[model samples]
Target: MAYKPLAHIPTHLISGILGVGKSSALLALIQQQPPEEVWAVLINEFAPAGMDALLLQDQVPQDAKVTFAEVAGGCACCLANLPFKVALNRLLRQTRPDRVLIEATGLSHTRELKHLLTGPEYAQVLDLQSVMTLVDARQLTQYAQHPLWIGQVQAADCLVANKTDVYQAEDYQNLQAWQMRAGLADKPCYLVSQGRVHLQWLMQPAVQEANKAPTPLFSPIISASSSSAYQAASITSTVRLTLSREQLAASWQTWYQQQQKTWGTHIRVKARLSNMQACYHLQAVGAEYQLDVLPLEKSSPLSSMQRIEVIAVAAKEDIQNALTLWAQELGILDEA
Candidate 1:
């Protein structure tokens, strides 16, 4: 059945694996929401620590009135998805908004998430607008081994190949494979960067139907299960640590040199920290990363100490060691 426009609370489940800019996309959407409306969001994090809630809260206005519910510590597709359901239902009842957005953990499988929304239970409460899958055009090389990542692209109603600015000429071909998987060679798949998409891009194309759920290349039995391959760990401090830009750059480069070697992978690491110069938004994903200084007013609400989150496919001990060492090198004497 074709969904009636705005007949119920329209929901857009933003799906993508790590570093695809799902959070950045949500930030863009949040910035553009009608100033008078209340937007509710449900965020999922593979690592037990959830940073999306804090990150999102920082980007919105002091009085913009965005409500959030977060499910962390595991895959949202596990345990019959109780965590996800609980968060979504609670957010809806609390906010009672006309639209909702769920930013699933980067490792989430789209089929299971889609089923939760389009299922009979939520069919009346949620008007499934579309599933937007954000792909980092540069990361297409490693995606083949991550079956669930591809599964997400296959289930998307619209595909967005983000980070195009950094993509090479040959990378566009990845979209063809993605389109073929969805059996919608003509579907609205676009190339964009910086998580910016036209407002129209968010609306369902009047006639585009949902894609067939993907068949994972993994063992079929567990293919349907959304299992998390990453573990998250965090280190906090009572007060901000002082570090120079050069020091920050050097430490990050050192981590890259060590972690990018064979058998080591860092999915993502995010930190909001203050230096003598200014506050910065720092992030690392795979072999690439970024650090941007936020305007003073924008970063003013943050606490003195940085709250850091590290997501990795490595073992839990390795993740803790990596993060702890990172904090120490950054000049923090105590890791809270």
Candidate 2:
């Protein structure tokens, strides 16, 4: 089928870990696009704070006009199907945006999310633009080096490497090697820090100008999963807490490191803090020693509590244990 960027409303998937700077890049793009061009934003998270939603609202440049919706509970790729529908349905009803930007949770499986958008249900309503996955420069060094990172990096139409500020002393040669191994073709890899993205590259149309453009390949987890299969493996677990600002800040990095060490790459994490000082933080672990996080924002509805959502690839029993351990650490697993 011939895809037209204008024939259908184009939406982007800004995905990475909790700290890589997806929100930063989104802000940069929104800042560059004329207000009339921006349509709406779909912000998904694993947490409830919705801080990123608010920050993006404030950063949408005075001259820009855009609307936003927030989806939290889990990765929109997995748990938040209804929320996705509710958010998009409402946005579609109220605002007909030229473009839509979906800020996905860090742990979100971009391939899966793309499939959902391209599925028959939403195919007519939305056009799947490029799947943009943000990579933390530091973590990309580690993630792209992992055996399974190819599946993640190669799936992206554009692999944005955020946190360039942290890579000044690092070697890009390693990254080049990793990119080659990931079979990235001529796909663009951008280095951005403090949320600086190349607006021209991002805002350009995502549809193939012609049939000769290479077709992006999706992972089996996404392409092969039937609706029943998706329902069978999907588990939505929530963690709520009432920590003071100090405690919340302390738990952020500490909890991540702890989960990284304990889970050993089987868990995915996302959070939105109420402080509004930080963008949503998220972490995703796949195979052994593969972990990364980046900051992200989109927009969704308001929430009354602070929560985090987790998703993993495991049996129900294993997922239950993992969720329990995670909740135990936060001291709120029993609340629900």
Tens digits of per-residue lDDT for model 1, 74-175: 668864698788888888876787678889888887778887788788877888777888887556545644677867776777778888888777777765
Cα lDDT tens digits for candidate 2, 200-245: 5655444332212223332233322221211011222233445544
- The per-prediction CA RMSD against the true structure, in angstroms, equals 4.9, 8.1
lDDT of the candidates, in the order given: 0.73, 0.56
Name model 1 segments beyond 4 Å from true.
1-7, 205-213, 216-229, 262-266, 275-277, 333-336
Residue 321 local lDDT, model 1: 85
Each prediction's TM-score against the native?
A: 0.85, 0.60
Name model 2 segments beyond 4 Å from true.
1-7, 61-64, 144-150, 168-170, 203-336
